[model samples]
Target: MNKLLVAEQLVVGWDAPVTRPVSFHLERGEILALTGPNGAGKSTLLAALAGQGRIFSGTLFRAAGARLALQTQGLPPVAGLPLSGAELLALTGASAQGLPPWLAACLPLRLDRLSGGQRQYLSLWSVLASPAELVFLDEPGNNLDRAGRAHLQGALRARANAGAAILLVSHDPELLPHCDRHLMLEPIS
Candidate 1:
């Protein structure tokens, strides 16, 4: 398969000198799971891969036509925001066809009133609906219950089947079984 993303000697951290150099490769139509103890720089690595964080050293190569999507851990309530679920999905350039029935039904409700899992599911749907080649999911199963997690997993598998590369970061071990490969990060001493 063609390379979708490559990180060479990547150093991810907020502190100076970076904890240590990290490197990895991501291929198209594959899933890579990132796991490690808290503060191992998992989130930082994801941010860097998504081009949202600084790269202390090394280069990040992204294939042409590759689009990156990120889903943060905390699903903050957007309560008073004027935007509706459909509008939010539109903002991400995702098609409305990908949204789940429950989320579609709750679109008319305010974001604040929706349950945590509902928001998480909606956020994921918005990203999946987009025309993205690579997606970064940070703690995707955070607020999701068993059924919700199952739903999210199915959606992810569907996306992968559709030829999208997925990079999932989660503390839940349940997600590892679904990934094609797993990368365990360690803090640089």
Candidate 2:
């Protein structure tokens, strides 16, 4: 089946439900955006779908044997970490060919030496370029500048076109155009 995931009345949170029950499905070769206000639990819902957060109620299912990759808001502290940008990408099995010229040049440098946006983009590329059939991203556009954002949009489109199911959580208005559909979450009252 082309469908990669199915969620029905999924109520997810740490302790109590932070979002109203939401139902959505994701299919290969599509880009879905999760959008809402600050407290709407967009991140939490993504975590739940990835099997890393609590599901207080409802059902969530993934296609059998479907591989997935998830990119969260947190970036591992680069301080004194020996990893380089290229090394990070290599670890994730992602190629650097599509990286913007600026980022590509920084690939040989230690991640700690790169600027915030550079590190962010490198980390994003690790997930985006992976071979996972399903990709979950949370606030991916964070720390990205205008050019970075444009590159991200293009990369997302390329990934979707290549048959990866992408579900990203973002508040950036510019990212809406790259999405095939959106699931808007309302904060629980």
Candidate 3:
């Protein structure tokens, strides 16, 4: 397979090792689900992969020239800003062709005027639709309504089909069915 990311006995953390040494590999056109209870280092691992967190041990390898996009938990502090959804997409270079009708209609509206879910979904699309070869999403389902979740699943599938590797960190079981494989992280004692 075309490996985009490979982690061998990887241990990631902020101050110290927060994750047990775990190993995994990801390839283009594949969706990998990272799951575990709270404090299991799911988000930490994603951060480490995105070059934010520290890798205490082992190793992580990425395709030499691959670009990446990451969407972390919580909303961006763009509220009250003058940015519109369309502008956000433009900044990220993400297209609006596949946006849901409701969100599409709100494209011209300032981001602060939209509901939380709308903002969340729009932020997510910024990452999902970007040209990045690898995508990392942390708690992607947060604040999303039922329809939003459904759309997320479809978007993930489409991105994978289009040859982008995704590392999804979600607690929602609904997303697992869309993933090609799953890795369960364990908390350290």
Note the clash tally of each candidate. Answer: 1, 0, 0
Per-residue lDDT tens digits for candidate 2, residues 141-186, read 9999999999999999999899999999999999987899988999
lDDT of 3 by residue, 1-189 (tens): 499999999999999889999999999999999999899999999999999999999988999999999999988799679999999999999989889998999999999999999999999998889989999999898889999999989989988999999999988988888899999998886
Candidate 2 residue-wise lDDT at 166? 97
Error of 2 at 158 (Å): 0.3
Candidate 1 clashes: the total is 1
Worst 10 residues of 3 by lDDT: 71-80
TM-score of every model versus the real structure: 0.90, 0.96, 0.98
lDDT of candidate 1 over 1-189, digit per residue (tens): 478999888786655533367778888878889888887888888887777677888888999988888876776458777767777777888876755676789886666678878877887778766889998888888877887777777788888888888998887878789888888888766
RMSD of each: 1.8, 1.0, 0.9
Candidates ranked by lDDT: 3, 2, 1
- Give the candidate number with the greatest TM-score: 3
Top-lDDT structure, candidate number: 3
| Predicted structure 2, TM vs. truth | 0.96
Candidate models: Cα lDDT each: 0.79, 0.92, 0.92
The candidates, ranked best first by TM-score, are: 3, 2, 1
